[model samples]
Target: MPMKPAPDAPLCFHTLIHRLEKLKLNYLEIPAAVVQQLGGTFNIRLQCSVNGAEAFACGLVALGEGRGYITLSSKRMKPQGLQLGQQVAVRLWADTSEFGMEVPEELAELLRQDEEGDRRFRLLPPGKQRYIIYHVSGVKSSQKRLDRALLLINNLKQLPPGKEDFRAMLGLPPREAL
Candidate 1:
């Protein structure tokens, strides 16, 4: 039987953080001590609540030696007036969302309608599935989202199991052909 989902107890932390000089990206570093306290591998998905606000899904990007950081986007920071080089309160919980990300309604409906496509998509690793979902949902137009969903699922169904390539899923020519 599948294991029961853990309770929603967030691991809280207050830390000083900084952004890269050349990039708009900001991140929170999880030290080896914190990693050990969390009792998991360096890389893991998390739902982060910043400054007691709403939670958002993110991943802990590993940096070796049991260290990792969660990237914070400008879109999420500007509204809250968050700045780098400031001490911030963060609460993190394991991300338990299906596919580790939100599935766009268009893709979810398409998958519901296409049994073979759904089967192929479900066979893909969670990260790969997130890639497709992100691509489909990135656009603002509903028609465009539907079009992308159809195109991606159609491309996904054509690839052999265990050999699905990201480029192929996007209907792009192989890198060598470029």
Candidate 2:
């Protein structure tokens, strides 16, 4: 059986009508009152569904003065025929998945088979772990996913604990060099 949401979980959004705003970027404003009702903070991860589209993992980004917004990337908007200034139905739910986002099968299986890799991955901050997971899971090809998972785990293990550098893990030059 699946576990139920905790009593205090900010599991729903009250707003159903919101205009997609574009000021150098596209997003929908989350009312301050709604934010207050959903735990009064902007730090929680969420699963958002727009206009009944499939829910996608996201977070409420602070936009000052107690207001927040979830950005809609063009990649996300285009496929759904989302247009600027259009009204949308946005629903939000508390993200309860481990690691805050869905872990891809390739990465999950690799971590399960490699003890040291899993240990190193767990030692990183949650945000860093999400970054690595996103990188590995963003592609469309299974071979590419496995390749990225292998690359990340191998590079992660090469670094000492508590001293991992994302740039180095991706084989990029030190940030200071750029």
Candidate 3:
């Protein structure tokens, strides 16, 4: 069964939306006081809910001063009828899952089919592994996700430290202009 957001998951709050300048992506600011309350472990995973929707594994961004934020993908927002600048309740818990998020069946099967890919994938940091899993999960089509997973795995043999190279090799969009 997919993990559900726990009422006991360390923290819960109502946050206002904020847009990343230039990128135009919308996100929810996780307050610094809350971050400090969570012991400043910004790299940690959380099972998060925006409003009352089903929860998904979320990672907190830890960049500059205003960096404690969660990306609010349209996929995860539409069903709940969310909008920019709206205050919504968010529940967050420490994620204890093996992959940080639930493993997409497509990616899992592809990994199982290629031992070398599996080895290389396991060698990546847990966060990177989850990023791959989450990236594959972003698409609406199972076929597309499977296709991306194949390209990602095959390229993992010599892929570099940046996501853009992987995105280019996978024929996907660049995440940032940088």
- What C-alpha lDDT do the candidate models reach, one value each? 0.82, 0.80, 0.77
Residue 32 accuracy (lDDT) in model 1: 64
lDDT ranking, high to low: 1, 2, 3
Q: For candidate 3, which ten residues in a row score worst on lDDT?
A: 1-10
Top model by TM-score, which number? 2
lDDT of 1 by residue, 1-178 (tens): 2232253777788866767557657888777666665665645677888899899878877756877788888888889898888788988877888777788899999999999999999999888888999899899999999999998999999988998998999899999999
**Candidate 3 segments exceeding 4 Å error:** 1-8, 63-67, 140-144, 158-164, 167-178
- lDDT per residue (tens digit) for residues 1-178 in model 2: 2233353453455342344435666776788766766666876787888878888888787877888888778888889897777777777777888888999999999999999999999999988999999999899998999999999889999988888888877877788999
Measured against the true structure, the TM-scores of the candidates, in listed sequence, are 0.83, 0.84, 0.73
* CA displacement after TM-score superposition, residue 166 of candidate 1 (Å): 2.3
Q: Which regions of candidate 1 deviate over 4 angstroms?
A: 1-5, 20-25
Residue 178 error, candidate 2, Å: 5.4
